[model samples]
Target: METVTISPKYQVVIPKSVRRQLRLVPGQKVQVIAFGDRIEFIPLKPARELRGMLRGLDTTFEREREDRA
Candidate 1:
């Protein structure tokens, strides 16, 4: 695993290998989420680029009786 130190300005530089592997560009945006203790960085994609990403996903599920109508 690669380690990075947060700079005095509260910024951390993502390593080169990690950047290349994730195909991250110089100005790409990422969503920063914090849960419990650790943080997660998720790359944000444009809506147009997200087209048909869930194709063939199982979307059918049983509904409750009262909600079925």
Candidate 2:
């Protein structure tokens, strides 16, 4: 297990090994979720890069439009 110490500013550095494993880069945004006593970090990509993944979903665009309509 890896351990990191939080600085006085309440900021903790994600270690090199962890950064490499997660492919995290400087200025990358992460979604922080608080689940009871534990916290989760989820990486977010630019919306444009996610277009293909959204297109691949089984739901059709018309179905989504009708639901929202």
TM-score of each: 0.80, 0.68
Please give the CA lDDT of all the candidate structures: 0.91, 0.85
Give per-residue lDDT, candidate 2, residue 68: 67
Q: Which 10 successive residues of model 1 have the least lDDT summed?
A: 60-69
Candidate 2, residue 29: how far the Cα is off, in Å? 1.0
Residue 1, model 2, lDDT:
64
- RMSD (Cα, Å) of model 2: 4.1
Against the true structure, candidate 2 reaches a TM-score of: 0.68
Error of 1 at 38 (Å): 1.5
Using TM-score, give the best candidate's number.
1
Q: List the residue pairs that clash in candidate 2.
A: none
